[model samples]
Every structure is written in structure tokens, then in C-alpha cells.
Target: MSPGADAPDTGRFALRGRIVTLDPADTVLDDGVLYVSGTLIEAVLPATAPAPPGFAGVTPLDTRGSVYPGLIELHNHLPYDVLPLWQVPKRYGNRSQWGGSGNPAYRTLVTGPMKVLGQDPRLMPAVVRYVEAKALVNGTTTSQGIALFSNAGARRMYRGVVRNVEQTDTPDLPEAASRIADVEAKDAEKFLARLKQPHRLLLHLAEGTDAAARAHFQALQFQPGKWAITENLVGIHCTGLNADDFTVFAAHGGSMVWSPLSNLLLYGKTADIAAAKEAGVLMGLGSDWSVSGSKGLLGELKAARLASTAAGSVFSDRELVAMVTRDAARILRWESALGSLGAGMRADLVVVAGTHGDPYTSLVDARDEDIRLVAVDGVARYGSGRLMRALAPGENLEPVPGTAGEHVLRLDDGTADTIVAGLSLGEATERLAGALADLPALAATPVPPITASPGGGVRWQLALDEIEPTGAELRPRLPLLSASGETHPTGPGIGALTAAPAELEPVALDALTASDDPVFLATLAGEGNLPADYAGALARLLT
Candidate 1:
């Protein structure tokens, strides 16, 4: 969309209506507006701003509803099958006999036993894939999966989880530790490698206990930024792992996918929240699945918030929102694209209605039906029933499928050309960095040319552009750059919008033409988080 009269073509997008951008500092726009172009975020101004100039020719998408970044499910998967609780009891009739109790309380107890008793390993992967698909439609764009174990004899710790499967050590108790390490080793390797291609992978390396967790790390010869360690490799449900495992995860600088309810429901525990925090690991909360927990993140948030506080310190409502938004995006390593409402990122966004007092608490307590609209890259994917019906009577727009937008930018999807076609310089640069970063092999190598516009015309753009937090009403400044090598800085801000390829000066130029308030440019080459004298330092470099 073009900027309205009297406003500069800042290249940012405006979703209109209620816009929710999950930056770490928890900045939201009520009756919000977003400014996106190419793949960088130009600005996220309030709706009060007059439509920027040049918008006359641009097609305006009147969301007139809420908008949000695409939702991401960190510790989830594509399930092959989602059997009913009752189905499990009959399918593997003797599963309950392992505990010698057909009692419903031990339904979880039967999971390990059923699988350990020679269920084909090949089926597990497909079953997981099904669950992954379900999550996608539930506002989940990304999911995580752990290595699946085969039988009771696969891993010692896994046997311990379902000792009743083959109760050699305890009577009527599932064996938590089995000799399935060999099987798990193979299965884990396959699952991890599978996650590398196409699907965003979050490996749940549950090694039973802390001691075993450490040992697995050593065995895997894990190294930072090696062996398909894409930015999206999140560690999930890692309670049994010790400090060493945390260190290994930290050294890699990956995120942690926490499933508090599922953890408590199935294993009576969740990941070590305190340890995860101390390690600087980005923390993303999950709902697991209805099989083990509720599909709603609201419930997941309540469980994790309470659990995290008891296990550590109290977490504010904003913190809970972060777990689902900014922090979650960070863990996915998709902070540049999917998590926020900055310029150049996907226009995928969500909006809620009637939120007046507190956005975070309201969002945490938000119901599924409360979602007004969900867009995928600037287009509405899910429109509220009331809004859609009101907009076009007798028109029934299909809601977004769970996995509908997985690869929307691909050439075959008919949306290839439109990808990032309208982003600003800041967003464009960020998109460049994100796309290039995916291939660590190439990203690490030297490249030629430092031209700002690699896509030829300013309209041409690249993919990988689609994809933070706090609260307490903090004020921060973000810089804005214009087409004419000018920079305009805003007031106090939590994050900056910069350029990529380490050579373009678009952001600096943006600051020269931006508003009087302090503004900061974000860049790939730039160091992470510089609070003191940032705008001045950045200003000097860009100018």
C-alpha cells in the first residue's frame, strides 16, 4: 500500500484497525497501523498518523479488524495420528496391564508401554506430522519435535518413563529406563536431520534425567552452528538435562520451547525455567496438544506463568505474552521476520477486539473466537465471522488451513512475485540478512557487490523476509530513513531497524529524513543490544 498524502513513502505497511506487533518490548498499536515493505520493517506508527503520501495508487486493504504476526508453535509437531484416549486402551489392550491397573489416571502410563511393546517405529513419524498440521491452523506456523523412542529396550531413561511396559525393575510400573539408546540414537538422528529440511525443527532432547541428558550431548558431538543447526532448532521439554546440557544449548545460542502443562500433565515436570533463563536461552511457551494438554496458549500461559514463578521468580503478564510472541520468535530464530510488526517482515498479523485496559493480559486471556483476523504476509487468511459476514453477505471465505501458508512464497504457489514486493529499505535489508543467514555455508563466505538494491527495481524483492519483549510501559526510539539518503531518529526505543549485507547505508539515510525523535537502525553486522548512546553511534556511522 502507498503512503497517504502529507506522509512520506516510509515503505512500512499499515494493517489499519488493531495491529499487534510482538516486539520484545511489548509495543502494540490500538486501532493500529503497520508499515512494511520489501522485507524490512520501516516503522510501526500509531493509527493516528495521517496515511503517508503515495497511497492514492496503492490498493488499500481495509483490515478494519485486528492484525497480528503469524502465530508460531515452538514445541509442537506434525502428528501422523491423534488417537482418542479410549482408542489407546483397546488398540493395545495389554498396555494397562503393564501397570496392572486399567485406571484412567495412568492413561499417560500406557503411552510408553504401547510404543515400547514393538509398535512399528515408522508409524511414529507420520503420527507426529498429523499433529503438526493441526497446530498450523490453530494459529501455529512453527513447531518442534523430539526424537521418538521405539521400545522399552531403546533408552534406559525412556524405559523409566513407562516402566510398566516391561516391568523388570518395578512391579506394575512403567520402566523409565530401557536399553533403547541404540534405537533412539538412530531415530533422533533421523528426526533432527528431517527438521533441517523444509520444516522448522525444535528437538526435544529429553534424556530422562540431568545426568543422562549431559551424556547424550557428549555422544552427539554437538557444536555451535554446525550440523544443520539452523536458527530454528529449539530445545523442548529439557528437564532431565543438567547444567551441562543447558550450557551446550546456550553455547549454540538456540531457544528453549517450554511445554509447562504438557510437562506437568505427562511427566509431572517441565523444563528447568530458572536454568534456561540464566543461560540466556530464548524461552517460548507451548500448548503441546489436546492429547496431553489444551491447544489454547492461554491455558499454557497460565500454567507456565504460575509454574515458572514457583520454580523461579514472578513473571508479569507481559512476560507471559513474550513467551508466546517475542521470546517464541527468538527461539525460532525468526525474530527478523515473523515475530514483530517492523518493516520488511511478513504482514502476517493478528488482532483482538474490545481490548482497552491491558493488551497482554487480554491477549493471554483471549479466546480463539476473539481473534478478529489473521493475515499471512499482508493478506487476510482468517477473517472473523462477524466481519466477513458483514463485509460481504452470502460470501463465505474459507479460514486458513493449518498448513496453508507453510511455503507461500514458492514459485508454484502463484505468490512468488508478490513476496516482499512492497517493503522499505530497512525491511529489505533485514530480509536479505534472514535469507542469506539460512545457508550458514554461504552466509559465512564472502560475497561480491554492496549495492543496496539487489532486486534491480526498488519493487523487486527476495523471500525469507517473513518472519521481542517487555512491558512496564517503556519508551524507546526507532530511526527512519527516506529514499534520499536521509536519516530521521525517533525517541527512546527498545530495538533499531538497520540494513544487511553490511555495506548498504539505507538505514543511515533513513535516519537523516526521519522525525526529530531518536531512531536506531538494525543490521546483521551490528552487535546485539547497545543501550548507551546507540542512536548517536549509529547516526555517525550511517552519515
Candidate 2:
């Protein structure tokens, strides 16, 4: 949906909290009040400051927590949510060495399962929803990855998806022109020319700890007869690049995306972050994929801290936070629209319990449960059940089972509707373990061998049926409300709500249930929560 649609005419509301604005000045307000007008942030001021002259009747949403801009995940593969960590018998020098053609375990476990799942169009949306929920619960509001679902409707699930650069033969300038075949070089040239356009160019380059991996950066730099690197270039996992390589990249206005968890898992080492930073390369953080990475960007942030410390480079908590927020947005060329909490910018934000003296430190230490609210464009999409009701009273709120106080709010774009709540990080992952249980292709596919004898080789076997549901059983259980506006025990079916809230009258239960609008009432029940005062304000809101 276009961000403007269903843009809650929040007429005017002041989100009061401890604000951490990752602005150019790194402004932090101990007790801040952010006034939001529709989808834009109208003003950010101190809690004691009076409301601006024009916003007289604005409702105050007391977040009572630490508020900050939503995080940006610069790189990820959403579809890879289906795969668990699959270790091979031996390590390889680079991704190509293992992923290209050498490893039987990769083929049998990673590639084989993906190919099988890709054949079924029916399962793609489910996988997409799973991954999007995984990111949202972790406080990530923006994510960029290769498009997996063709449905435009899926785009409404998140705040934004970075537009993908068209794939060409060079996919991502693999190696220097001379090192690659003639046909590949021609493809790389074609790809490089398109970089002149205004879109962010992303590619996985030098992602290993070997000479060949480091050489990829050289190939990109001297590409023989191609255009030079530009600011649009975003290199992912530069595990092999050295200090000199980073200098060359920074000189050409290139940025790097750090996926330390994945790098450490696959290559036993990560990028020379100290070198990259010293060379003035803009850095962003990403949660590569579940296969070899942390659960999401939150976990990845911790990994980045550990990696930075081990490398003898100390990045303050605020700097680390910027890597996922402001710096990441700059890398994607979205600085004008996102990255910081400011007036005239979209209200994509995250609210967590304020437990530390420093907001940035609190953010780095936050868990999924600590996330009190996550909003995109002024609309609260996920948060505590009470918070969701207070923010968007008329909209439907679905309980995110397995989470102590979490819930998902439904969003309706004029064309379609999508949900934004998810299982807690751990619960979401547990659900993924059995995602392939019903896919027959997994069982039908043949397993390749790492050794000569069948018994000595690793096999592609999963006890799918043994996996249990990770969260609460989701059955359509709608609470029945009496004519007096009191919530009653949930009944067997939605048949109890025969009349829409707008049509209900002050009468006995029998008369209320016999009124017209059963269809509309049933629809509300399916979506979930219906407040006690829903019949009064919500009736007008829904109509």
C-alpha cells in the first residue's frame, strides 16, 4: 500500500517517552514528546514544552518508554527462513568453493531443499510472512533483500523494501574483468553501466578469508574498461578485504555492510571493520540469514560488538546503534526519508522499555519482549495489547501467541490488508523448524553423499512430524460482548455476533444477536480484538 493510505487521521497525538533521535547531532531527550501529524513527525520537543499553537486537542499517547527510529537491515535473504544451520564436513576457502559445486552437504541440505520448496507457489507467501514477522519482532522496520514474493500485496507488510537492482550476468561484479571469462566480463560491464542510475547497487564481494576473496575487490576496482565505483555501491560481507582494499573502496565512495555473525560462522573470521572504519567507509549492519547468522539484526548487533572488541577496536554503543539506523539509511541512499526521528520524516519508530541510563545502551540490550511498540508511518503495527488499543482503537488487534505481552495490529491498504505481529524471536524460529513438514518434495528429493559409502555419508533427513507447534494454537476464538458492553466468555463460533457494532441497540442478548450485519461482525471476529467501547466509537470508525 502507498504509505499515505489508511494513514490514521491520528489528527494529532503526542508520543511522550525518553527519545533517542539518531539525528546529525545525535539528540537524546530524557523526557521527550514527539507530536505526530498523520504519517509525518510534526515536532519533537521536551516533555515540559507546551503543545504547539495549532495542536490544541491532540491526544497524548504516553509510550512511557524509550523511543527511537526503527532499525534498517541492509541485507538479508527472507526466503532462507526455512533453512537451519547445515554444517559441511570441511571448510572451504570462499562461498564459491562450497556453494558453487564442491560440497555435497551444501547441495543436499541447502540448495536441494530450496529448489524443492521453490517449485510450490503456494508456500512462498507463508515463508515470506514468517521472515517478515521474524524481523519485525526484533525491531527492524526496513529490510532489503532479493524479492521472493511477486504479490505487491506482500509489500504492505513492512515499512519499506529497498528497490532491487535488475539482475544481469555480473549479478554483483564477481571478480576483476581479467580473472573472469570473456562472457562474464561483458555481463559485468553491462551491470556496471546501470550503477550510474540512482538505485542502490548491492553485491556480495570478497566474502572469505583467502587470497582469491581479497582479489575480488581488486577486480571491482580495476575492472579494465568499466565505470569506477560510486556511492551507490554497497558491498556485503567484505571478510577478505584488507586496509588497502578499504581505502580504495572508500575513495570511490563505496560503503560496506557488516554481517559478522554469518562471516564468523562460515569463514571463522569477519571483515577488517577497524580498517574499513579508518578508511572512512560507511558501514551498516545486517542479519544475513538464519542459516549461519543470528536470529535477526538485534542479535547481529551484539555479534558486531564482540567482533569489534576482539579486533581491538572499541565502537561505542551509540556508534554501533548508528550502523543499523542512520548509517544504514545513508548507505541505501534513503537518508532524506529515513534513518532518524525528525520532523518532515516518516514516523517509523520502535519503543522499548527504558532500563539503562543511556538510550543507546538500552537499545543494544533490549530483547523482543522489551520492544513495547513498533510503528511504521505513524501507525502502530505491533506492540503490547494495551498499547495497540490506545493507539489505534478502531483497528483490529491480534494476539501474538507465545509472547508475554505482545500483539500484532492489522493494517489495511486500500487494495489489500496485511498483519504485522509475529511470534517472539524464539517462537518464530521454532515454527520454522517444521515449515517443510507438509512439503512432499523434501522427502522425495535424493540426498547426495559426502563419502563413498551410503552409511558413511550425511543424509538429507528431517523428522518433520516430530516438530510441534511453536506458539499458542490459533483458533478463531472471539469474545462475545453483551448488550451492556461487557465481555463474556468466548463461545464456540462467531455466530454469537450476528449484528455489527454499529447496528447493536441497548437490549437483551437475544435481540442484539438477531440484528442484521452478521457478515461484517463475523469478519471483525476473524481479525481478532473488539473493544468494549467498540460499539460506540468503532462503529463510526469502521463505517
Candidate 3:
């Protein structure tokens, strides 16, 4: 924004920081310059290098922190993230045992409520606005898209400030599928054939600690030694898989996404990550959802570190950080364009509060308050007030709550979905919290336009994947035998919401960022499934 800046129309600017480029050699420049032009990174050079052509007159931003690629969350149910953490009722053996249909606690606490929220046209925009903002505060640039349904049951992806892996209109950013066609899912042969067509398909696999959960994976071997997994099949939470199972997964070019906290909270244990590592399986970390999981990938990283230590320091800070950065991009088949800071790549990166200590740990251990800036496609979306004023002036910035009011968010740019425009963060938080507090009222209320809706007049209600049927399932309940030798799916699928809620169960809205949640640390420590040492260590670190 300097006086002599050349061609501001190109949106050219320079950011200087301690860059941690996760290139092939893992390059780190103590004082680096990230030159950006429009939507792509022009070059990553040292501060001593001569300024790039168009950046000569533009004043460079001294981030005064360590810079890394924006965190890419491979797995998350974003809409459900508005709900607070679930107080697990008991240790369940498998996904089927505590099916969203059978368990009153899950049905009443999780699925039933989401069903109402996702179906309401008037409240749908609030769901999209709140969750996407939550992702921004936590430094996540890309995540799974929210699937919406029309009155006639037409499906569409929710477009928002956050880059959705499900749909990216541009060719460089290939669209990944979180939901496949119904035809592809019901048949094993069809699912395998879809994997061979060259695209990343994220599906939940073996999500429990019992034999029934393991059977979901075992059934993938349609015939002896012939598995349905391929590099394109990115399984979410292979908790039920054994060391040998990971060997097979890697052998078939498959990868895995781990949500340690969610697994530990539901079952008594999590995946045997050490075994997967031994088998050379590529793994990425996901926050899953706010209920029974970390608020975001930042908290997820801390939980991962704790779990890693309990497993005898199985992964270093560098490896754990990579899961959400470099490794995560690779899982989505986008290594060349994102998940790393490189020339000609997308300008998606984050700046944390420090330039000292282990750079990798700086990012892995950071909280929301410690984040200095988050830029996606070279546009500042969230950051400290000073940085936002400089990077995104006249963009109608809103103060991001849960950061002690220190950080601000700018979503009014062309980036935001039309449904989210003109909607303040405060309004979205209030309406969503109030709706969750009274589920019965929300379900019974008419869909007529209310004064609070910010969508102008567009009624946008996306079907919540895994809750309501949206063509295909996010987690495949592949065919397997039940304990009674009944042929059925080993894992649970979209369960029937048997009846309407009879009572008004008040549920607290989940905290926007982990750093601001008063009880977030305590809840992690109190989880009965986590080992005493792991729980204690996490508490002490956060405290």
C-alpha cells in the first residue's frame, strides 16, 4: 500500500517472515520474502534478494513470526462443529454399537439436532457462516465442503471463504470427493472401479476398536488378496485395523486420516499409528468435529503429540505438523500446488507468533491467540487487527470472538458465499446457539422469512452428510456379517431418526477457538478413555 506501489490492480504484495518451506528438502529461510501476485505465490526468496519486479514500490509486511502453509484439515463435519464437545456416555465397541440410530445419547445429542438444523432453510446460512469462521480462527485454509439440498432434493456444495476440497472451480485445484455416487458405494466392485478413475475419495473406514469395526476393512478384500483400496481411497480413522492391516493398506497405495481424540473419546483406544508408520502408510490428521473431538486441527495436533508420546515418541513434532500441511496436501493429490510454500503455488499460508525455537513445533504447538495472520489465495482473511488493517483495508473487517477480541476476520470480499454476505459473526453465533438450545422449537418453527436471515431471500439448506442421505455415504458400511452371522454392514450408515425430540434439551454452543474455551483443556484431561499420563501431559502443556 505504499505511495509508489505499481499496478495495485494485480493485488501484488510482499510478506516477510521466517519462512518454513516444506519443499522436497524442507527449506527454511531465517528472514524470507514471500512475493505474491493475485492468487498465486510469485516467489519465495531471502530478504537479501533484490525485490521482485512489481513489488519494488509496495511496502513489505514484516509478519514478525514464523510462516508456514495454511493448515489443511482432511476430515471434519463442519456443521456439527458448532455444537460443544460430547460427554461420552460409555465405552462403545464399534460404530454400529453406538449407532446414531440406536443410541439415545447420540441421536438426542448429535444426529437429531443436526437433522433439524441442516433441514431448516432460514437457519442454514447461519450454520455455514459460523463453522467457516471457526475454521478461519484456527488457521485452516482448506476442508471438506458442506453438502446442501434444495426443496426438491437437489444437492449443492456450500461455497464459502474457506477453500473446499469437494469443489474448487479452477483446474489446478482438482475437486476431491467426500461423497461418491450411490451406485459406487452399494457395490464393492463399483467402489474399487471409482478409485481407479484418478481422484481422491475420502471415506471412513474401520472406525472402532472391536472385531466388528475391523470387519469393515476385512470385507474390502472382495476376494482373497484382492482389496478395494487404492491411493485414491483415503480412509478416515482406521482405528480397528491392526499392524498387518496397515501393511495391506500401504501395499495397495492407500493412505489414512487419523482423528486421535475422537477415537479415544468414543472407544477405549485409538488407531495403532505406530503399526501404520512401520508399514510406511501415509497419514494425515483431522479434527473430526467439535463433539467428541478437538475444536480444530491446532488442538488436534496437541492431542496427536500427547498420543504420540504415550506410544513411546512414535512421531516427532516435524512429522505431526506435516500431517496437516505437506502430508495433507499429498493425501488430496495436490502436492504440486498447495500444502507447501513454493514459487507458482497458491498463496495459502499462516503466520504464528514466534520466529525462535523449533520452527515446526512453533506451528504444531500454536493456539488461536498465537496466530498472527492467515492468508488464502493471497488475500488476508483473518489476522491481528494491525495486520488486517494493512493487508485488507476497506474489506469490512469483523472482530473475531474467542481471541480476547484481538484478531479480526474479513469475509466480505468476493471470496465469501452470497448466503454469508452481510451477516456479522455476532449474529451467526447468537442464532445458531439459540437454535441448538431449543431443538423442538427449531424443528416445529415455520420456514417463513425472519428478520434475522442474512441471505436476502435465498433458502439454502444443505443436507448434512452422514446424518441425512446425500446420494452417497461419507463412511462406507461395507457388507460384513454381524455377531449373529447376519449379513450386514460392519459399520453404521445413515440411521433413521426414529422420532421427533419430545423435550427441549439445551446444548451450549462450542467455543470458536480452543485458546478461548475455558473448559476445553479440562475436558481433554477428564476423558476416561485417555491414559492417565497422556491426559496429564496434555493438561500441563495447555496450562
lDDT of 2 by residue, 1-543 (tens): 123344455566678889899999999988888888877788899878888767778766788799888888777765564555434344456665555333444444554455444433333333444555556666777665323222221211222221211221122212111011223322334345545565666667677889766655555533343334677677888888999888888887888889986776566678888899899999999878765665567667766776776778558889999998889877765677678988877677889887358888788777666778888767777788777888878776656544545566443333222322332333433333444543343436433322234344322221111011112111111222345644454222211112221211111010001012243333323322222332233222222
What is candidate 3's lDDT per residue for 35-112, written digit by digit as tens?
888878888999999988878887778999998998899999888888887777789888766755577777667776
lDDT of each: 0.40, 0.58, 0.80
Residue 83 accuracy (lDDT) in model 3: 82
Candidate 1 Cα deviation (angstroms), residue 209: 4.8
The candidate scoring highest on TM-score is 3
Q: Assess every candidate by TM-score.
A: 0.50, 0.71, 0.92
Off by over 4 Å in 1: 1-14, 35-43, 57-66, 80-137, 144-201, 207-233, 243-245, 296-298, 389-543
lDDT of 1 by residue, 386-491 (tens): 4443333343244332222221111011221122223222333333333323333332332422234544432211110000012211111112233453434322
lDDT of 3: 0.80
Question: What lDDT does candidate 1 reach at residue 154?
Answer: 27
Error of 2 at 532 (Å): 55
Error of 1 at 43 (Å): 5.4
